[model samples]
Target: MTVTIESVITCPSCSHQAAEIMPTDACAYFYECTSCHLLLKPLAGDCCVFCSYGSAKCPPSQEQKGCCA
Candidate 1:
């Protein structure tokens, strides 16, 4: 499968959305919402913020390689 690099992350606190590039080699544990400035972390059972809040899962997960986290 083709892994998508881009993802749209939505902040639960302010409902702000931002497009971001996910890391290919590692998981992004933290993210800062550009609009609300709320720090984001992966929810339980997720490996990265993208998995918990993004439109797409991170590259490693997309490729079925589990999570680098």
Candidate 2:
């Protein structure tokens, strides 16, 4: 199976969304909403914001290699 690196992250505060390329070496813990400027963090049990709000999981999670601590 090929793991996709692209993720469409949606901002919960303002519903803004963006397609971003996830880095394979690390997890993205925070994301800022472009429309509302609200800083987002991983929700409980989520390793990164992408896992919690993105259409695709973070690269680490996609590879089943675990994400942020």
Top lDDT prediction, candidate number: 1
Give the runs in model 2 whose Cα sits over 4 Å from its true position.
Answer: none
**After TM-score superposition, what is the CA distance of residue 52 in candidate 2 from its true location, in Å?**
0.6
User: What clash pairs does model 1 have?
Assistant: none
What RMSD, rounded to one decimal, does every model reach? 0.9, 1.1
Query: Can you list the residue pairs that collide in candidate 2?
Result: none
* Candidate 1 deviation (Cα RMSD): 0.9
Model 2: how far is 35 from its true place, Å? 1.0
Question: Which lDDT tens digits does candidate 2 get at residues 1-69?
Answer: 698999999988788899988888888888888789899999999998889999999877887888764
Clashes of each: 0, 0
The lDDT for every candidate, in the order shown, is 0.94, 0.87
Return the TM-score for candidate 1, rounded to 2 decimals: 0.95
Judging by TM-score against the true structure, name the best candidate: 1
* Tens digit per residue, CA lDDT, model 1, 1-69: 778999999999999999998989988999999998999999999999999999999999988889974
Instruction: Give the per-residue Cα lDDT of candidate 1 at 67.
Output: 97
